[model samples]
Target: MAHPATDDARLPRSGSALDVAEYFAPQRTSSEDLPEIEPLVKNLTIGVLEVLAGVREVDQLARWLGEDAYRALVTRSNLSARARSARGVAAVRPAHRILTQRLCEPTDGVVEAVVVVAGPARTRAVAMRFEGWDGRWRANSLALL
Candidate 1:
């Protein structure tokens, strides 16, 4: 009798084993293969600020963010909404200007940047890390200071 493993008809006949983990894993794209990242960074910075300010929904920016970053933004957005509720402050679109942006590339496909924004109330800095994945830029980490 044939062994159960060898008798399986579902296995590939090509003789080359398939690596399920690697096949399903997120693909990392090189910087050379990606589009200009500056525009994406700037847009994402503004989008994130809007989300946290409750002027925009986190889902609007979900496609540009990784799993962890998306979850964190959702949590932060919820907290902001709760705080607004507590203070009885209606959600208003924040009027702000992007003051400056500083970026650094520690790796070929990864960029770390900080954007300084000026608002009517105060100036704040948003730090973010973007990685090239599957031919697009995705925010993997973000922090507002």
Candidate 2:
């Protein structure tokens, strides 16, 4: 008798396993399928600045950020907090206004944006790249200049 463990019918076809795994993985949605990108980008810019300024907790924005972006924000926030502690500065809401926002879509589900913000101290730009993931936008990369 043939061994049941070695039965070909019990195993998935060569490439079907990969297909099955991918089917269960988080799906990538196109920008056309997602909500407006401008609003999300603007919100994230302000959120990131607030977190760095010690006025907001990084966890508050975790839902919209990818793993790497979230970790980077946490690290930057920690550094900011340490600096504030050394200077004996208390956390205060940063006064800033969004000046200009420019967005570009290089591919179907990706958006790159730069937002200029005018703060009481100086004007700065926040750059971010967003990807449509699982039917929503997620920030995978962020930088404040």
Best-performing candidate as measured by lDDT: 2
What residue runs in model 2 are displaced by over 4 Å at the alpha carbon?
1-17
Error of 2 at 28 (Å): 1.3
Expressed as tens digits, the lDDT of each residue in 79-98 for candidate 2 is: 99999999999999998899
Assess candidate 1 and give its TM-score to the true structure: 0.87
lDDT of 1 by residue, 1-145 (tens): 8886887775666533456666667899998999988898888988988998899999999999989999999999999999999999998888889999999999999999999999889999999999999889999998889
Q: Estimate each model's TM-score.
A: 0.87, 0.87
Colliding residue pairs in candidate 2: none
Which pairs of residues collide in model 1?
A: none
**Could you tell me how far off, in angstroms, the CA of residue 7 lies in candidate 2 after the best superposition?**
14
Clashes of 1: 0
